[model samples]
Target: MDAGTRNRLRARLVSLRDELLTQGSMNIPPARTDVVSTPDDDEAPLTHMTQAIASNRNRERADRLEQIRDALALVDEDPEQFGLCEVCEEPIKPRRLELMPWVVLCVACQEKHEHEHRSPGSRKHLGDFQ
Candidate 1:
């Protein structure tokens, strides 16, 4: 890739990393409350559960942000590696790169990775990253 393209992609990845960090703010523990017979009191448990779920989502987003940071490091070390498939060593499609600048695999390789490695009844494979 040219210098301009590398710079643009690097800028974009940095922007995304910042945006994700801002969005994935640490979930605050629910505040303690006094005994009260109100709708808010009745919904406290559900609210806490929602907060827990949001916290988990935020943690997942944080992990992706780490991946983006790693990709940025790789970009700095070798801009020529950008947009090239790690598995096939071919140029990844422009649209795919546009959509996911941190991607390290082409669509074909990604699909294959998912099919071969992803478990049917398990959480996402955090290792087979983009």
Candidate 2:
């Protein structure tokens, strides 16, 4: 990438990191204490589910923040290698980089990596559900 493009991406990463940090901490809902008091309450499960969903969303945000930080570090430490695929050592497409500046691999290598890393039996055949 050219110096101009690298600078632009670096700015974007920094902005994203700041935005995530300023978004405030997770607001996980407290577990329902009334579940025992009213065993017939239909809303108890809903409360718990809301808490779980909030926790997962926060976790995802945290992970994304970490990725942005890593990308920024790479940009700072190795300016020459910022846009190159980690596996193939080829320059990632400019459009791809624009869309996801934190990605470390190009499209082909990323697809291969995901395919290889999938757990066994994670995907079931359509007939399995029949």
Best-fitting candidate, measured by lDDT? 2
List, residue by residue over 18-43, the lDDT tens digit for candidate 2.
99899966797666555566533687
lDDT of 1 by residue, 1-130 (tens): 6788778888999999989977657665663555563447778788788788878887878778887998899898977887789999998887777778988998888887887887788666534464
In lDDT terms, how accurate is model 1? 0.80
Clashing residue pairs in all predictions, respectively, total 0, 0
* Estimated TM-score for each candidate: 0.73, 0.83
TM accuracy, model 1: 0.73
Once fitted onto the true fold, the runs of candidate 2 whose alpha carbons sit more than 4 angstroms away are: 33-40, 119-130
Which ranges of candidate 1 are over 4 A from the true structure? 24-28, 31-45, 121-130
Error of 1 at 115 (Å): 0.8
C-alpha lDDT values of all predictions: 0.80, 0.84
